[model samples]
Target: ALLGDAAHPMRPYLAQGAGMAIEDAQALAQCLSVGNAMVPEQLQAYAQARWARNARVQARAIRNGRIFHAQGAVALGRNLSMRLMGERLMDVPWLYAGGSEVHGFNGNAL
Candidate 1:
């Protein structure tokens, strides 16, 4: 590989990424380990929490990747819209925050 322009790797559209994987794995493993000690409702809650959140992220990542690869007006619009939207959207708490499983998906008791 030869050096060229600096590269900023595109964020994985899947969002499960490294951080998500760690969180999901830890949560899943812990939830699973509890076995019969964990109620079915809580188990369902764990799945609901992980799947819903990750699904949303994966969708957005795919969309962003498509936009990044888009041509003409579509590309311009996506970039400009993101610029106008500010960096806060880029620094999403939901994606980067490490403790999502501490309180479950909605942050209330599961």
Candidate 2:
């Protein structure tokens, strides 16, 4: 089964390539270790577990890339908004909280 970059190629803006790789490894291992599951079913489980979370990360990374590379008026407005909002603008609760259900292991390690 594919894992890490082979499964999802993420942009560098969010600096999540390595982090996602670790998560992928964990999810894959967890799936594979489950008893009574065939290899194909285990692989499918891994994919299902990671698909949405990886998509969300990829989308956020692309968006951050655009915001980071903004030019002219957009850049100016972005900077002003960031300054006004401060750290609150950078806080992503969904990302940092890291819900286990999305990982599909229910907090158990392989």
Candidate 3:
């Protein structure tokens, strides 16, 4: 399974965490939809697509956490960056616009 941080996860500075996870699941589904047909090649394809993306995320998260925890100037910069993005962040429609792709057990796509 895919994994992210165990503790002190970075905020989605680029608004990617959940989206990335959804994309991962979707991509995995696309890769693994063998239609009752399983084979070594299918598994290999899924691994090929997902592993690189997962590694990129892990690397980015570590870098972001370091930036957030860096010395005074860097920490200040991080905070300032948050403030600069905060307003647009709150209003971004993807944060709330529920859709079918975010499906749930009740058939709610959100």
Itemize residue pairs with steric clashes in candidate 3. 102-109
Candidate 1's C-alpha lDDT? 0.56
Q: Is candidate 1 or candidate 2 better by TM-score?
A: 2
Report the C-alpha lDDT of model 1 over 1-110, residue by residue, as the tens digit. Answer: 10111111225654446655555656665555554454674565556546656555667777767876899998898789788887655666766665455344345543
Better of 2 and 3 by lDDT: 2
Give the number of the best model, judged by TM-score: 2
- lDDT over C-alpha atoms for residue 11 of model 3: 57
User: Model 2, which residues run further than 4 Å from truth?
Assistant: 99-110
| TM-score of each model, in listed order | 0.58, 0.87, 0.48
What ranking emerges by TM-score with the best candidate at the front?
2, 1, 3
- Candidate 2 C-alpha lDDT tens digits along 3-34: 77988899999888888888888888888878
What TM value does model 3 have? Answer: 0.48
Q: Against the unseen true structure, what C-alpha lDDT does each candidate score? A: 0.56, 0.81, 0.53
**Cα lDDT of model 3 by residue, 64-105, tens digit:** 667757888887987887788976633546434432242222
**Model 1 CA deviation exceeding 4 Å by range:** 1-11, 14-16, 33-45, 82-89, 102-110
